[model samples]
Target chain A: MDRAVFFISDHTGITAEALGRSLLSQFPDFRFERTTLPFVDTEVKLRAACQRIQASQRDSGQAPLVFSSLANAGLRTLLMASGAVVFDVFEGHIERLETALGLQSAQAVGRAHGFHAQGRERIEALKFALDTDDGLRADAYGAADIILVGVSRSGKTPACLYLSLQYGVAAANYPLAEEELERVELPRTLRAWRDKLFGLTLAPERLHLLREERRPGSRYAALPQCRREIQAAAALFQTAGIPCLDTSNMSVEEIATTVLHRSALKRLRW
Target chain B: MDRAVFFISDHTGITAEALGRSLLSQFPDFRFERTTLPFVDTEVKLRAACQRIQASQRDSGQAPLVFSSLANAGLRTLLMASGAVVFDVFEGHIERLETALGLQSAQAVGRAHGFHAQGRERIEALKFALDTDDGLRADAYGAADIILVGVSRSGKTPACLYLSLQYGVAAANYPLAEEELERVELPRTLRAWRDKLFGLTLAPERLHLLREERRPGSRYAALPQCRREIQAAAALFQTAGIPCLDTSNMSVEEIATTVLHRSALKRLRW
Candidate 1:
């Protein structure tokens, strides 16, 4: 079944989107497309998302499933007629909490539970890696919950580490070597668990700018090298059917969330 | 001088507020208060905050030192007349980054650095502890840059561990014992490092709920005992002159940020 998710949140879109990703991480192999509309109180934003979902169905020529985690109840009627399966986290969690607590869920108190599922393990793992100074924490193929493969200075290491620090994901990043790029093949270890492998590539100019920070005058930071490696990496990723994201202008939050949301193995724990 | 810190940010206020607490940790003798205004956009919210600062000054009969890290340029004019010393992180790091890069300040890109700088030793200690599974990370008292102490569920342990992981700060935490609470005095090891020791306390009810999750039908989770221990802990903290936070309502992000913001010894570095 085709599936698409939409988040209509009261605050910023980040909360709903983050919640969606964590939940998807629990349910792997669900072909899902998801998007979020912030400040959904307005009809215009709501209608645009609805139209976009409709367009996706039209383009694919397949009936799609829709799940909404909305802060607003007003959209319930509006979305019911959209001909997509709808599962709402807001209601699901609220019902569960109320059942357990044997009382009505207060908005403030309930919101607290949303943040309770701690990334404690993830945070601890990061500490273990950083504390030991054992460079293995940096190796992507072995320890990472998600391995980020990309050309040098494509924001692989920091982004993966940030994911580890912030979310408790054991994010190990492997840089694409020139030899690997020449072969246009994924890393040997990466090929074993192709499902967990994700690629991050950026614009050649951006790569040069980021690299110039570490080594100012070197062929390693040259634009030609960046362009070549990125092109080769993209080709390998496409060949392996591993999803790749172009993180050229995206913020760290955007890049991490996009990868989490679009990944085939995302299971929703939040 | 009496000091109180306020964090204003375009991002989540929880993060700014956490960072503020971290900065405060640096000056152990400073009597400081802290608060945050997250997702602040309206004129009324700003005005209310200014009034609160004024009221605080009037009550204390002293000019309050205020640390504000505002992301928005709009608040500058409004706060110019306030009777508090405001340090803005948004503007503070620009020159540092430029000097490091040996580039003209104007030519330096603003959003470049995001990594931990201090406490590498502690991270290593924690890593060594976790790998050996010896729980010796607990015994890393002398090596710790800072030590955390509180009751079982007061968030001391995780916070210290987070510091160890993120910045490699040697962090040791000791849970207060029943006898220690009865004595209503700082534990021996904590008293020895009075200047470096920080305390964490949470609302009794919240502590009870948290304890109940880990263990149900235990004396620790009982409301009466929870209240008693928390009160005793607070009294001990007051006598020791160690600043403590009531972490019941706050998220982990909030707690960690406040610790970092207050810790004078650390700063954001790559």
Candidate 2:
């Protein structure tokens, strides 16, 4: 039987969902029907959420699991009365934080995703990522905090976007073209920015599958071509003393975090 | 004095950082010095993190606050002994989840950001977003889950990127060009997909500043021009019966979440 899970929050529900999903991933035995209720600050919305939880409980014949980060005390109290097993994400920690800091929490709503200077930085970084995507403007590499280089379809674009969006990092990517792959040395345009370059490489089989999805039955998607490109990229990374990550088993989040860790680049906080 | 805050995890520390940041936002009185230690699954790394935390405590004259989602029991125990005020993100919740579902957790590490089907979906969505960005490929609108229509620099590209990266939503964006803004009606190309269109508008002052950052001293950056284009876009949204959001005060996260909520689009779970 599939268990019902609800992520409730006063704002965008992103934090709640992220933490809740992490917890749920540990429990692989059960299938979950998940729902996210964001912007649930007001009493009216709280009541609506209560009704939804009640419905889920009635239908499933079990109290649904509710993970919430409601900052408002009243709405949180009301939610607890909804006959669901609620896990307040901030309950145990907020009081402890207050005690540790010797201060009171403002308990404000929707401060997590508010527009601020960090937001502007993220927008600018995103623009930089798009502008320099696929090595379109190598001249802009001077301003990039980090540049990702890899064979085509080797997970450069998504990693760059994740770094920009999540941490406000100015990340640009250059896709190694066929001509560049045929050579053993770093591309001339990338040599000057070698300090900022991070390489992404994947298994030849995985690369073949990825390229095949884009263009099946083509020489570009052939396994031999994928193997040759991967070999050349790895050799280039070794010769240039550039750090490279194998991205076959890693998601963009993992890849981006690994890059930051290996490169010792601090994630800029907004 | 700023308190040190550590986000520790066995995988990417994104979940820990997100939830910790949200909790800390409530206590706006004190400044926090934050560090993230991800992929800390080994005993060596755990010892290193403890050293960092102990160093922070010694430097700050107070124990640091550690927020962790370490899945391994031994490492988690080691983390608890680090002498910091540890808030294990899954400590209290995982047991409850096991009892609730009558199953034990897999207790795996790095499950949150593993390369999976959803990761592939997200990469595909990102490619679609880039391919169709700024009305480059209007014909590709047929494949988009949602099409964002807005004036230039009104938060279209970032929102589309967020929707794709976070939710695997194939979002495409079209900038309302100067000629299209002059008529006050939906563009002829957009007329076909009006149902999937979501409009984004911002305050004229904000729009003017944004445009000025891109192209200084241009007529497009003038306040009057900004106001005129905004008015025309607003009138066109009304004429086309499309829902619109004022993005002056919202982040891309907020904008993407609201679009999902308003459009009744379910965030795809892998």
Candidate 3:
């Protein structure tokens, strides 16, 4: 039978979904329908969530699996007995933590991604990332926490976006165009931000494939062109002593983490 | 003393961090030093993780809080016995799930956000989001799963971006410039894709505040101008019979969720 998986949370259900997916991924053979019930911070909403779970169980003729990060003890206890297989994503751990540390968890609600408390800062950071994306607004460099420099399709854009969305870092990326690639020195605009400059590089084969997807059979997509550009970019970054990361096999999360770690750039600690 | 909190995972530790932070945020009075350790897929890595936890305990002279989403049972057992306050982010749930479902989880590793299996698709979607942002490439609308429309700073860009990054949705956003807002009708390019079009509106005060940050005291940032633009934009959206969402007082996650639900757009389904 196809199973139902619910990710329920008092705030943004991102955490419940993430942890639940990691576990459910292990059981890939089973067919599953996933639902997210976020901001279930009220008793009324919790009742509706329970009704949905009970309905899923009735419709599927099997117990539905629930992964919850609900912080309210009363709601959690209510959810646990809601006729579904409940997975308290945080309760057991919180209890253990409370005991080991001789402290009690405050069980606060909706602070993870509330955004309202610090919405202006995060919104500005996100705007900064979008406005300065792909070197669109070079004049704004003075406000950037760090600037990512790379050849086209070296994974600069997504890395910047991830850093902004996940860490509230004001990241801007500058593409090393053909002229800059052929030059040994860093671009004129980047020289002023030398300390804040970071580079992203990738394998020639990967670059060729990524470019080919956009412009099939073009000179830009040729393996030789990719190789020469990467070599030039690498040399330029090396001579300039700019920190670089190879994003050929790394996910955006990994690239962002590595860049932040290597540069020690300050994140707007959300 | 500041408490140490570690978000441990077999993959990108993002899940552990998100949920852990949500739970920990409740205890606002306590100071915390957060650390994320991803890709703990081996015994060696687990041992090193234990060492880190042990050292934290020793340095702080207090039990360190660990939130883990590691899927391997053997490794989880080893981690539980580590010298920290262990929070099994997934185990108790997984065990109960197995018993209730009458099936065994595959215990596979690195499946949540494992870009290796689907990186190309996600990268393409992200690139699409960037290229089509702010109506840059209008011709590419045919390729988009959904198009977001609203005046500048109406929360369209970030919502589009979040949809792309999190769910691999090919979301394109267009600004309702003065010309379009004054016309009282959807733009020519958008009229063709009416079914794919979604609208984002925000409170005039919020828009004024957001725009003022970028360009202080300009017409674009004036409260009166914002009020007029938003009124015209909302009227246009309403007259055109297009569905719209108000982004005021809502997080980007909430806006994205509401948009996806209202439009029933197909998510890339990662």
Candidate 4:
């Protein structure tokens, strides 16, 4: 028999229930039952939740676990019946956060992580603009509060795109060409926006990981060129003092947030 | 001094690091410093990571709070020298899973969530076929391997979209119309694909929470309608014996996973 799981919560039970239900997808054999107590915000609700868990177990003829993000104190106790295990995602994280931050647990219940990703809106808009592939201009740098400059696989586009989406920052990025590197000078348009510019560089191995996704096994994926280009880019960012952040170890989200936080720019939110 | 929160991991640092980075974006005032020990397989790597943390403390003024997820044996000693409070995402999860499963700790050192969402390929292909104003299809109940039938604002679209993006599943959903509820008989097309079809229902409150995103205030947005629609639709699902999943407190991911798991269908890659 497939083991059953139940998801219960304090309010609007849909979302709280969903958080636990989603975990079931990973374990295909497990079955799920969800109950959302939206009307009652009292101890009675918790008792009701516990009763539902008991009923599900009795009906299913299996020990179905309950995963809840309960808000009310009564609800938490009601969910504590011993027929099956309970994994409370909300309370677990709330307790962890309290310990981590040296504070009391959160007053409310439910998953805390349902926010829009930072910089996503701005990233999407900028991606829309850059897809036009227009050349750099005087006003382009001015319109863009921050500019990302780097070699092809050094993680410019995705990082900039993430920034725009999560923080709503109008980020623009231009690739550093071989000639531009040879000249070793910022573009005339970017010279004025130097303080706002950020550079991304990566180790050869990471650049290779990225390039493999694009062209597979081409000269563009060559390690030597990757090393040389990364070195040149790092030198340029260092000399230019452009607040370069290496994308070698950072994920797409991490790289984007690092740039935004470091720049001390107002977070762009919708 | 602004708080310095660090997210570090031993394996697949990219993913673990990305999740942590997303969490940090919630706080704008904090000075976030992100560093990753991408492949902390050997003791040498562990020692080096420890040294870096020490160097960071001595170099920076603030005591960096480390959020680490390490699966290896030697990291505790290395991190002990850093003299900062730490919270590991996987430490508790690992302990619980081990005890529950009666298995030794896998010590899986990364955020490795496998792909288990159902129905993306058909949906993406439908995106190619999309030319409707009422959403995806007039005959959606006919063609879907799993048709998500729900009342409006019941999280059908996002669940379908997530199925399309994450698991490569071809998910289609049809809104429960007033006329359809009155009939409550399965639509002719739905009867043909009854085995493949599933119902998505949510608590009235959850339905309201979801609808709040699109239209805030109106008689259409009142609780009575929400309660009436949910009860009617759920009763309809019950009479039909169509497997129904409630989506109130759930995320898009949870809904999709629940359907895929319950249906025992292969999940598509998003």
| CA RMSD of each candidate after superposition | 23.3, 1.6, 3.1, 10.4
DockQ of 3: 0.52
| DockQ scores for all predicted structures | 0.02, 0.65, 0.52, 0.08
TM-score-better candidate, 2 vs 3: 2
Q: For residues B153-188, write the lDDT of model 4, one tens digit per residue.
A: 676655664454444466777778877777877766
Tell me the deviation in Å of residue B192 in model 1: 20
Per-residue alpha-carbon lDDT of candidate 1 for residues A1-270, written as tens digits (9 for 90 to 100) = 335555554333333343343333323344456554444555565677678778877887754444454444466556656665444434333443234234553333112233344445554545443432322434434555677778776766445544555555666666778898899777675677676778888888888877776688788888787788778988998988878999876655446545655563332221
Question: C-alpha displacement of A68 in model 2, angstroms?
Answer: 0.6
Clashes of each: 40, 0, 0, 40
Q: How should the candidates be ordered by lDDT, best one leading?
A: 2, 3, 4, 1
Most DockQ-accurate candidate: 2
Write the residue-wise lDDT of candidate 3 on B1-270 in tens digits.
578888788876777777676777666666778777777889998999999999988887887888888888888899989877777777566776678778897877665543455666777788888899898999999999999999998888888888888778889999999988888998898988988888899899989998998799998899999999999999998898889998888877778877876786655555
**Better by TM-score, candidate 4 or 3:** 3
Q: In candidate 2, list every pair of residues with a backbone clash.
A: none
Q: Model 1: runs farther than 4 Å from truth?
A: A1-103, A106-111, A117-119, A124-144, A165-168, B1-251, B260-270
Off by over 4 Å in 4: A1-49, A55-77, A81-83, A88-102, A111-270, B10-60, B73-81, B111-113, B116-141, B145-160, B166-169, B172-270
Docking class of 2: medium
Error of 3 at A242 (Å): 4.2
